[model samples]
Target: MDALLTVVVPVYAVEGFLETCLDSVRAGLTAEENAAVEIIAVDDASPDGCGALLDAYAARHGGLRVLHLSSNVGLGPARNAGLAEATGRYVWFVDSDDRLPPGSVRAVLQRLRSSVPDVLLVDHLREHPDGRLEQDASSPLLAGPATLDRLLGLQHTAWNRITRRGLLTEHGLRFPAGWYEDVPFSNPVLVAAGHVEVLNRVCYHYRIGRPGAITATRSERHFEAFAQYDELYQRLDRLGAPAAVRSRVFTLMINHLLVVAGNDSRMHPSCRRRFFRGIVGQYRRHRPAGHRVPAGPAGLKHRLVAANSYPLYSALRAAYRLAAARHRATERPPAVSPDLSATPRPVQTTSLR
Candidate 1:
């Protein structure tokens, strides 16, 4: 059967959670949709048993195709390989450590086939360590045509959206090779796409705080986020994107810098220094006209960053830590579930660098 949708899952060291993730993909579809769905699982030279497990599943499944690379390419190149091989009309990217909720595939496919939009944006539930689910609330604002101007609030992860393969090819879009690859790739996709739709349902289960997960662990690689945003702005400019779209991306860049800077403990001094310098460079290069710093601590932080004031930046970090400690002191403990242990963990590996 010709696949209506192709799911591209780039697997690395995700052996501990791959089975559950694949299981969710299997169970999420209705019988008919399952038959029409094709899964392309790319094993980017996983150091563990993930490749063998994917091959085993492929051997038993009719619509599964497993690709094993000769060497460990990063996630971006692995996804490019899968995208090149996909034959489905529409393509969806999924992470090997995450999964789809039950009935999600069926519901998404129903809407997808009916509307056949160039890009389909959907919501996700963040699954915390204690088994709590927090659904993202930005989908309501995405209903109309003005979504490109509001890209910062949207989840930029590739898997949360299903996009037409033709649209990607038309725009000559491919992921950049780095930690913050999604920002460059996703921002352009949303900007170039003509027909976009948002599904307000929480279709994906995104695990947060899992050990060894990219978001859970921090490294100097986090600093790569600045370069990624620089790429985004460059791409937007080359493509002649509207000023409003460019402004939104610039704001998102600012937000990303603040996020990395706020984690003072995880960052080395050298990394922090580079972060401040890089953000200031981006602000000067990309800050839209009429953008003013609002009055607040955040505004002060932005101002300090603009001026490249190291002492004030350090002070802000200290203040942020104190505020966070107070908040933690006042917060109640999370409700723990008995099945928390059942939740899977990502495999630990240092090969991404």
Candidate 2:
């Protein structure tokens, strides 16, 4: 029988985290549940020992399958290769650096059996470097509505959504190569999905600030975000998505580009001006009619981009950073406090005087 779910993990230089990731999928699954799910790990020509490790793990686990590629094709294409071989009703592209939480597989299976949605969106926790786990802020939105605008507002990650294979194949929806691949792939899936459901349970644990992680690394490749958004806009146009949906996507595109522009870790220092220029061009090209920018600092950023005022934006960013530093300093608690017990008494000062 064909499996119900296919979990495609694209492995690169993540040997350190691969075992935990693989184990998490099978951690709490019963034999029948395990049999009903397929796990595919693609060895994307990683320079590290990931390939050998995958082979060893697959040898030990009868159900695990590993696909070895001759060349490194980045994360998007590696996932595509695994999807091509998937034999499950639904497909999930999971990153090797991340892991599913305990009972996550069971939750997903239960949902799939009951709902059979074209797209099943689940919640996730973001694991920070300091060992903190925080639920995604938009988790509540999942239960409210399954509209494309609401789906777009949620986190734009492939791993959070388990999609019906037929929906993807019918729409020719595949991840494109390059950075910000999720932008193009995730949005289009949400737009194309006819029946969507949300699983409010936290199914995945995403690690943040990991060393050598793409989001934490500084590179000019981040500029690929522009091209990816361009592809997404074109796809939406072809799909004849509603005007509101397009406008929402345009807002999200500007917000994402601004985030990349502001992030010190992702955007190189030298590329700041050029990146701002890219943002300005995108704003002019994609900004919808009568679109309302978000409120507060974010809204201000949208206005700045619309006006093409990079210099003012730079100055405001600097001032905001300075004020934030000061605010943090003020909010810090005292390192040490006076101990009243350790202090000497007045010692009958009145009598002594």
Candidate 3:
């Protein structure tokens, strides 16, 4: 019998965290639940000892499968390789640097058996460097509705969404090889899914500020976001999605580009102008008809993007940063001195005699 769920983890240079991720998946699963789930770890030609680690772990764990690729394909293609080998009814593309919380697999299995949705969206906790856990702000939206807009509004990460394997195969959906691959893949799955369900519980722990993380690394590859969105628009056109959906996606694309433009960690200071120009080109190409820009500062940024005014956009961003710094400075609490004027009192002690 095929397993009910397949956890596809694409491993790269994540030797430091792979064991925690693998262990967490089986942490709270019962014998029966364990039999119902399978794990496929794709070693994307990682330069570290991740492949050997995977093999050793799989030797100990019954349902854990490992695939070692000869070449270093990026995360998307590695996930594709794992998906190709998956034998479960549903597939989850989990990152090797992240892990499921205890009981998360059980919760997901329960939901899948109950609702049988084509797609199941779960919330995640962002694990900061200081060991703090914070729920994603968008978690509240998952409980409201399963609408396309709502799904699109959620984080465009692949791990949060558990999709039926048939839904993906039937639609010929596969992650493209590049950065921001989730944008092209996740959105379309949500758009094409016949029925969608949301699990409000925090199921995944996403590590933030980790070394070698693409989001935190400064590189030119971040510009690939534009190409990813282009592919997304093309897919939407083929799907013949409604105007409203297209409009929402357009806004989302612009907002995403703006975020990339503003993130110092992702976009280098020297590349900001070129990235902003690319955003302008994208705005001109994919802007849906009769689309309304969002309100306030976001709307202003949209206008600047439409006008292709990189200079003004840069200035606006600078001003906003300055204001934010000032606001933070003003909001800081003053240090207080401890009082030393209190009279001394006799200490009371309890005797065990």
Model 2, residue 330: what's the lDDT?
Answer: 81
Report RMSD (Å) for each prediction in the order shown: 6.9, 13.2, 11.3
Among all candidates shown, the one with the greatest lDDT: 3
Clashing pairs in 3: none
| Candidate 2: Cα lDDT at 7 | 94
Tens-digit lDDT string for candidate 3 (1-353): 89999999999999999999999999978899999999999999999999999999988876799999999999999999999999999999889999887778998898899888888888787877766666566766766655677667888889999999998998888999999999898888888887777777678888999988998999999989989999998888877788989999998889989998999989999999999999999999998899999998889999999998988999999999899899998795332111211112222111111
Q: Which candidate achieves the best TM-score against the true structure?
A: 3
Question: Candidate 2 lDDT, tens digit per residue, 1-353?
Answer: 99999999999999889999999889979999998899999999999999999999999987889999999999999999999999999999889989877778887888789877888888777777765676567766766645566778887889989999998899888999999889888878878877777776677888999999878999999999999989988888877778888889888888878888988999887899899999999988888788888898889999999888989999998998899899998895332111211222111100100
The regions of model 3 sitting more than 4 angstroms off are 327-353
Clashes of 2: 0
Off by over 4 Å in 1: 136-146, 264-266, 294-296, 333-353
TM-score of each: 0.88, 0.91, 0.92
Candidate scoring better on lDDT of 1 and 2: 2
Q: In candidate 1, how many clashes are counted? A: 0
> Candidate 3: global Cα-lDDT?
0.86
